[model samples]
Target chain A: MYQYSNFDHEFVAQRVAQFRAQVARRLDGSLSEEEFKPLRLMNGLYLQLHAYMLRVAIPYGTLNGRQMDQLATIAERWDKDYGHFTTRQNIQFNWPKLEDVPDILQALADVEMHAIQTSGNTIRNVTADHFAGAAADEIADPRPIAELIRQWSTDHPEFQFLPRKFKIAVTGSPHDRAVTQAHDIGLRMTLQDGLRGFEVIVGGGLGRTPMIGKTLSPFVPLEDILPYLEAVVSTYNLLGRRDNKYKARIKITTHEHGIDDIKHRVETKFVKIKPLFTGEDMHILKEIERHFEPPNFKPAKPPVEAISTTSQPPAFRAWLDTNITPHKVPGYAIVSVSLKKPGATPGDASAAQMRALADIARDFGHDELRISNEQNVILPHVHRADLPQVYHALRQADLATANIGLISDIIACPGMDYCALATARSIPVAQQIATRFHALKLEHDIGPLKLKISGCVNACGHHHVGHIGILGLEKAGVESYQITLGGDAGEEAEIGTHAGPGFGADQIVPAIERLILGYLHLRANETESFLEAYRRLGLAPFKALLYPQEKKAA
Target chain B: MSVTPISKVVTANDLRSGEVIYLRFPHSWTPELSKASVITDDDLAQAGLAFAKGQANVVVGAYLSDVVAEIDGPKASHFRDTFRSTGPSNYRHGKQEI
Candidate 1:
């Protein structure tokens, strides 16, 4: 919801101009591919398996109607008819020509958005909780801090070419929807002695070697955060492994040196770094906060007749139950527009659906929309009275699935089906599982389950944090799926444990079904969710259920 | 299972259109794999890769990928390559549009 300043406007225009020139040079054969690759990558362009993928950043997962409309226009005009929203809260256009990227970036710049630092070994887009300002449990809005981080990290000379790609996530609420623990640097907003601060969790990331971030500084005051962060990153830049790309992340650095030694190094670096802070970031934070001011609330509630179980359609009722969550204001609610409709690819929105979402946001929800890390769209300030209209609009656009957090609401990355880095296909397996669950008619009964799949060990789908995680891999040149049990991305977060050996691609869906059905039998009652049930019984039950024949034979 | 020496072809994405293209001999790129230059010999395959890399201005990420020599043309040896040559399994888009 933050609007760009004049400086921001000028800066982005210049960056786009520079990229346009770079694109031209590359096209004219003035620059070699080796020379041009870094330039294109720095601008968020990658040549994937089939085509060039342009990842446009949606900073802190917030955007307005006009921006969304432009995104729709871009999807329709330049690339394919759809754009895939990623777990990083960015939208990826899969088929954009290298020549057209500059124009697309210019289009993005018009909306105060850019793909800068979206790729390459640089500070990436700063992510925040989707329900940042509106969530009832939030102590503060994390977006201002996220915006500050974005500004500081964007084109920062010191950390531009880090040993590895750096990621940072911010969460304002205690409930932890942002999965802060799974980022390179996770900052959970905290209040101590009536002062706003961050519980800085460092080194945690999910990839080839998944790690839960260790708490670096539990309560660094908001004013000192920048310097503290610089120290941490500077320490990492020097000490992080440059020898192997695989072992280059800050997590590996922490793993090698241990958190205590890393902390000592950070503290030593902080002494030199702290004096450089001139309180300019505070002014910037204030400016950013001004842009994020909440809309005036008019009190109203859902119609009594609408809530009547007897009169309402069960599907609509189910949708209301699953998709609606309480807003900070009494009469307002956060409506999650589900992208996971049955067999549809997760997080993929057609241009028409994007336009429809834009219109709905503009007309009904104060022109505010959020892309959740869970790969769903959020109308964060929808009045309770507008629920029926919103739902109607969403239904018309094929956006209403009633499967948010259900079995069918799977978060899957564009795996081998699209990604050059992917080892196996994720989308097909996700579609099959969702379709199977829909056919079984048990998702609503199963309730509040999270299923996530990633193409490879790169945890783009947040598979490590899912209640049930499926990782697709290539084994002997054939697709095999690995299952993990009992991961949760919440206040109480844990990486799911590997259940057993992998299943064949064809075997994955049935294996998931068996696991869920087994979960149903193992649960003390229906109220206990899959994660809760798994916590009670441990991995053995789920593991046995997933591969029953093998378990039985063993 | 024992394997024999298989044919191979060079491929890259066309720079302007971002379409998957196979290297055809005498300096050309084509979406149709059937028209691609099939390298039965290992030395020629490496030569094809070198030639493909030279078409940098027209394409990007050029490399040699395994293919099964067919009467018509070379076919993708791996499923991943097949998906790349074709399009996604979940959707009919890209080269699979026809």
Candidate 2:
């Protein structure tokens, strides 16, 4: 984890003090609601459907045990004893009173965390692959670059108010765990002639107009990333539309002016600015990289007798198979703690569960934790020898669900249930689908599947990237859900295709059941995943499954 | 022919606590929808909304929400308002806890 320097500490403290004064002014009637709204949003406080929600940034989704413990303390003290980890790899405290938000932000600052840039039109928190440093196939650790971007973009005066909110994601791995394709700017680290650089993709977004980002440059050397990025954002800042909020994102900007035109503009800008960078950014990057040095690894192996198939419970074996990922180190593993427990809210963790995870990270693994974009917690470097103990502790904490990439592991946004922007409730729909699948005991058999639900077209849940995507909308005062199939957020990213018509809230679960069970019969074999089957067979068969009556009539 | 006006109530979030609040008759706010003043008259509803918006120190984002007036009180016409009146379906927090 990157420790906060004196400057960083002073900056955060100053922000907290300013926000505290702003809150006091609002309460005392000196600042009107119109004046206070932008101020509050800038600090990541939102008056949602029910109460004020505070979104705290976990930059690059990295935190240590003490920080996690402090998050638990804040949740218990001021919030509703639980925090909702969002798709953006940030945590939101839903029930915080407006008066206590400044205090909550101060609590966050104490642990070197803040809600700054988690909202507003300013560049939001920079995200990277959750398994950045630990993943086996990574070209390099992406977090140092991500941290550098965070530092540069934090209060960059020129880029403070873009036409719309901008997001950037970086991945060191070719597998694309960070959904790079669906960001305003996506940096995939690559090597050319033994030199490290990034394949810069621009204009990809998942909201109303879903687009897979186009590559602006095949590769920009690591030394020039900052100036290159400045050019890209600067181009968008100048050209992006302000006439309509709906079409203000870089995706639309790049779309209106073709990728070639945008590329030309970016290159032209890059050429102008490249000369101004006198290597200070590189120096800062070097300093940031020092904080992210890998933890010391001990050579060890899992106790054969303890983890042997005959002695271990099937649940433990299942957990190992699903929740664990191979680490770069030989005797270590990446443990994904599932926040999507069966029938529960998808990404919510109670204060006790957060503490339990912190303890496990401090004791069994390295004193580090990661919040994945998939809305799961990661113990990024757990020794294989400590698997049994970690599994037992997780089971005690109710975090040991053996459904990492299964049907029950759904990503859902805070729909009408909690979000002011949502037209329909997504949580209840996700809960029903997960509960239904769990009851059938077919999730493992279903194989690796991504079922994502967004409350609205905002696509906060990344529904456009799911293998099976459900989008909820309001039609004539009734909640309706439309399903999309064959979406993938990996190396070969593609937007999902809609499967004709929509289902009511009451009918969506059974509609999904019909599709999945239909898929079981339609697949070439059990090994063929839902996405594979959908690809081979196309939408005709799946559309029939969802609407059998229409097929019967046809 | 005169069209039947949609019965509505003035709604906003309490500025201090950020709780969903409904404006009652004269000048008061309650968290309960049933306690809210349902105005069937269009002009009166707009006046209620204006009054709610004017109380900026106590409330934020005040607007009129469609409702159906029953013998007991007002029932939310839209599901979104019903959610605001009750709470999120996922948890028994907010107004639903009471």
Candidate 3:
């Protein structure tokens, strides 16, 4: 919900003009690929496996109707008929031509958006809690801070060339939805002596070197955030290994140096640099906070028409049970639009579907939408009265899938179909798994289960943190998968444990079914969720299913 | 087979001082560039000036640089270094079309 200031607008426009000239030079043969590559990357364009991929940033997962519409238009006109929304809250176009990327960027700039820092070794799109401003448990909205970080980090002169990509996440509530523990830098807003500050956690990352971040600073005040973050990144930028790409993430540095040493160094740097944050910086933060103020709401109970129906409409009732959450405001409910419809690709929306969502947001919900880390779209404030109309609209657009946070609601990356780095197909595998779960009608029975699939080791799907994690890797000529269990993506976040030997891509669905049945068998009672049961019993039970012959012999 | 060896290399951060050397197909050779055996410091500077004047012509593609010869021959370190660093330069998010 943060609107671009005139400075922000001018910055993006100037960047667009610079890129436009660059693109013209490349096409005119005044510059070759070697010279053009870095310039294009700085603008968020990549020539991937099949075509150019334009990664447009959705800063902190926030977008208004107009922005979403611009994305839809870009998708429809330039690439395929749809765009894939990524887990990082960015959208990727798989087939744009390199020549047209500047025009696409200009289109995005018109909406005050760009692909800056969406890729590369620098700080990525800063993600925050999807329910940041609206959640009942929030002590303060994290977006204003997130926006400030965005401004300071954008086109940062010194930190542009890092050892590896860095991700930062912030959470406003104790019940963390942003998965702060699995980021390079995780800032959880906290209060000390009635003054709001942050608990800075560092070094957490996923990939080959998966780690849960360590708390570097127990409490860092608001004014000191930028300098503090700069110190942390500067330490890593200088110290992190550049010899091997795989070992270059800040997590590796944090792990090798030990958190205490890194903390001590960051503290030293923070002390020396703290004076740079003037009162003017704090004043601007206060001004940015005004943009994020929660919309006005009138107290009204659940609508009589919806409640008066003798029996709950099974579809609407099921949707409400899974997709709606308690809002901080009395009369409003947070509505999550599940992109994980059975048999459809996860995190994909057709242009028409996007338009419908925009309409729903403008009419029934507040003119705001959030893309969740779970790869779902959220209408943050929808009144109870407009629920039916909103539901009907979503249903028409294929957005009203009641599988949010359920078994079929899988977060998957665009595997071989789009991503050049992918070793196997992710979207189709996700589709097959969703179809299998629907066939068994076991998604509802399995309850809230987070399943994540990534095509390769990049872990873009966040397979590292799913309760049921599937990692697609190439073995010989065929696609194969490795499964990990007991992963959870919430306040109590934990990286998953590998169940055992890998399964063939063809065998993955049946393997998932086996895991689900295993969960059912091991449950203490039906009331326990999949994650709860998995946690209570550990991976032993799930591992048993994966290696049944060994279990039988034992 | 007339296989011309060309590898993509980035100029260092300094534009005035650095120059990228790529192979030129005979047709791609502007009459001025066809004469240089190893690009001189002056040639690199002149190329940069030509680019500024919109008179330079360079082609972008997956060129077949003589990989086996480059790796196995005497200038192996030069080839290896060029190949290793032939990626996005200091730009973080997207590539620069310099």
Question: Which digits, one per residue and each the tens of the lDDT, describe model 1 over residues A136-172?
Answer: 9999889999999998999899998899999999999
Candidates sorted by DockQ, best first: 2, 1, 3
Per-model TM-score (chain A alone): 0.98, 0.99, 0.97
**lDDT scores for all predictions?**
0.90, 0.94, 0.78
Best candidate according to lDDT: 2
Which model is ahead, 1 or 3, in terms of TM-score?
Answer: 1
Model 3, A1-554: lDDT tens digits are: 67889999999999989998998887777776678888988888876543467888998899988888888899888866688888888888866776678889989989889999887889999999998788888888899999988988998988899999999999999999999999999999999999989999998888877888889999998888888998999889999999999889988998889998999899898888778766676888888899988877756866634642648688988888898888887778889999888888899888898888888888887789999988889999888777878898999998999988888999999876656577777887899899998989877888888899998888888898998899998886577899988787777788999888888977998888888888888899988988888878877877888878898898
Score residue A84 of candidate 3 by CA lDDT. 82
Record all residue pairs in model 1 with backbone atoms less than 3 Å apart, i.e. clashing: none
Model 3, residue A266: displacement in angstroms? 0.8
TM per candidate:
0.98, 0.99, 0.85
Ranking by TM-score: 2, 1, 3
- What DockQ results do all the predictions give, each relative to the true complex? 0.79, 0.91, 0.06
lDDT of 1: 0.90
Clashes of 2: 0
